[model samples]
Target: MVIIKYYKGVESNLYNYKAMQAEIKNIDLELNELKNEYNGCSSISYEEKAAPTNKFNSSVENEMIDRRLKPEQLKIKKHKLEVQLQKIDNALETLSEDEMHLVELRYFKKLQFKVIAERIDRNEMYCVCLKSKIIKKLIPLIFLLDK
Candidate 1:
């Protein structure tokens, strides 16, 4: 068996794949909230002093620019969530059904190797080795999509 040393971030992403999925869903909700907030205008109005120079300045332009720029934090967060989601999704897609099932049993369901082996009609050692192989297979796919 080969021992693979993954970068900390990649390893975390792999082990926490389910958590990342949940986070992606949360990010989607947050993005929707931000969208609604951006679209819904405030009723209260405040007065602003005119620009000192003679340049034509309007509150409408400022409001437009603010609206465009204000969601940058959410946009960046959404983009990161997208990349993580894509990495996990693409990796999972590449797996065969049995391999996916093994992953579900181990990662998603958090089964012990003994339980997984019994469920799959395999020995505990075999299950452990298979999990290593599956993770090795997944690492490249995950990093490939990171780029």
Candidate 2:
């Protein structure tokens, strides 16, 4: 579906809140993979040589520096992603349960309003009105451009 967004005063077309959450989720997944790699010690390992050697001998005997990220670096990255996810979670927590549910169906699940109404056992118009309310509530929390 087509989505439009305006940053500052210029008009740009894209979904914002959903994309933000999606990015956070992606970062979390990446962090998990990094953690698994650290735990498994699967990252490449190498020894450093103190002095230069003959090119052929060095190439044969000395492996290149691992160039792999240290586990500590992975931990730092994971911590940062977790902190960002926490911020997003805190912002989402401002909504009531019902409002949050509607948002999840509409944006997260990308469900149609009619389907959302059916799932919630509400009339279509009621669902639309509720969505409007939810947007108003979320504007301050998610849509910084709205300010």
Candidate 3:
């Protein structure tokens, strides 16, 4: 048995975007969970009567600030990922139809070469060779997109 793993063009960026999306979802879930914890804790006072309410209020204020920061950070990260995905899409648009189809199947749709060959009615070796050529053509396009 043998295994070969390859990803080209915007494949990595797409994977990263997916991962960041999952992270954002997790952060959102955490924030929702924290909301319940926050409500529950609000009923109790810290350090009892001797501690001024100002101290308790400040602590709660600080906690709120910390809680807000996570979602804001995740939002920024998600936006950046979206920008990268957009750039990838623009680069993809410049390719010839055949090349674009190959790239889409390989990268965007994450299809194996054998499956792609079957779908496209070509031999696997031909598909492999064509993908190499497609990647060569995309190199300059990808660079241009970065500008």
On lDDT, the candidate that comes out on top is 1
lDDT string for model 3 (1-147, tens) is 111122343345543545655665776777677667653235445545555555545556667776788657766875766666566667667778887777778766789999999988999999899877765555555445332
> Tens digit of lDDT per residue, candidate 2, span 44-144?
33543445655433332222222244445555765665564554466568878888898788767778889999999998899889877655554445445
Q: Which candidate has the highest TM-score of all?
A: 1
With a 3 Å backbone cut-off (N, CA, C), the pairs that clash in candidate 2 are none
Query: By summed lDDT, which 10 consecutive residues of candidate 1 come out lowest?
Result: 1-10
Cα misplacement distance, residue 86 of candidate 1 (Å): 1.5
User: Which residues of candidate 2, in runs, are more than 4 Å off?
Assistant: 1-83, 143-147
Which pairs of residues clash in candidate 3, taking residues 3 or more apart in a chain or in different chains? none
All candidates: CA RMSD (Å): 6.0, 8.1, 6.8
Clashing residue pairs in all predictions, respectively, total 0, 0, 0
Tens-place lDDT digits, model 1, residues 1-147 = 223455344446766877867776776787677667643444433554454666544566666776677567667876887787787788889888878888888877888989999999999999888777777777777776342
Ordered from best to worst lDDT, the candidate numbers read: 1, 3, 2
State the lDDT at 29 in candidate 1.
86
Off by over 4 Å in 1: 1-11, 35-70, 145-147
